[model samples]
Target: MPAARQHLFLLCLLLPISLSYEIQLILVNNCNYSVWPGVLGSAGHATPEDGGFHLGLGEEAVFDVPSWWSGRVWGRQGCGFDGQGKGSCDSGDCGGMLQCKGAGGAPPATVVEMTFGTDRSPLHFYDVSLVDGFNLPVTMAPVGGGVGCGVAGCEVDLNVCCPSKLEVKRNGKVVGCKSACLALKADKYCCTGDYGSPKICKPTLFSHLFKSICPRAYSFAFDDSSSLNICRASRYLITFCPPAR
Candidate 1:
């Protein structure tokens, strides 16, 4: 082929490549437990000896959202990332940057960094849950943990089953919202039973359907079954959305 034709062919091949950008799912191995909190006991490896408060296993971080993850995400019962908390979904469990128990029935997730890669969505730091301050397993604490939180580690506070739905915001900007969008889910956050206890419901302001029932030290863990891995305090997990164009 002539030189001009060859150059044209090269441009055609590279055109698609230029439009896409690379995103990184960088893992910081925060908290410095350095013990390698693993899933199957052989999955992940811990690094540092110690640093700040160890995040433990199954604990993901929700870093400042990337510019690419602008669409909707799987929010749980209340926290809304895009202005609509769990209340928007049919299940009424949406929230901004949430940490769910399992992978919401998705395939074995491969934490990704780039926006246009083969891996699935890229989630910045996952919104982690707590079981209070007790770093040990449930068998050890029996009552569970609380928070030794400072800033990001501070026990994420939220009005659980509040009677009057308060406003929601993402860094001062409304994300998941639409006037009455904060309305409570029927048969779910009823004023009757189900999470009526102060632990589940505050009753004064409104029950905090999601706040951790932990002391000043320990954290309120979500799923007890995952305690073993969490106790390791080494192996940790992080989720993210694929970077955007």
Candidate 2:
């Protein structure tokens, strides 16, 4: 197997078997630097890890979440905090704190969204979304999901080619690519008010560019048909800076 797959397999073998009743999620940091991962559960769902944690280079954090949980995960970069855990990140900050709690990550950050299986249905739905924009290269894939299961993410770094108007820079380096909606704030770009409907909301040039590059991720709010992935996996892997295939 390739080195990346081999690493994933080794990580899977290390998972605890006692979490049979819950779904397992492994957040791996394969980047050269450390990453702070933020988690936020949907309404009525429980947030795990108190919503945030740190993962050093090549490190991984494992969680056994409720089987019926639904949440989103994103990475925060260039962050620092005091003893009180009060600070901010260059990208994807949440309430200027180390732990995001229930707050969502700021836009221009790559996001991994998931809904695990419930008692009534064994299907689990997940996807990597760029609708908010892109700050990191991330991937979400099933560890042992059965046939037809697909990976959802943008493996390529979008900041490198981000449009000048939509680029978010820190220290003279491009760190994120803002979505058209965020950069323009127009009803047409945001698909709000009269453009809220799918019939009226169409992909802009920027969204089309995003879609062309990150085909498996949501480029716009109405991008659902092909971006969503449904499966039945007890364990899923979310990796930051996933090695290029």
Best by TM-score: 2
lDDT of candidate 1 over 92-126, digit per residue (tens): 12121123312120111111111111123322222
Please list the residue runs of candidate 2 whose C-alpha ends up more than 4 Å from where it truly belongs after superposition: 1-20
> Candidate 2, residue 210: CA error in Å?
0.7
Give the Å shift of residue 125 in candidate 1: 13
Evaluate candidate 2 by giving its C-alpha RMSD to the native, one decimal: 10.5
Stretches of candidate 1 exceeding 4 Å from the true structure: 29-245
RMSD of each: 18.5, 10.5
lDDT, residue 123, candidate 2: 87
Q: How many residue pairs clash in each candidate?
A: 69, 0
Question: Residue 175 lDDT in model 1?
Answer: 26
lDDT against the true structure, per candidate, is: 0.24, 0.90
Model 1 — which ten-residue stretch has the worst lDDT?
A: 105-114
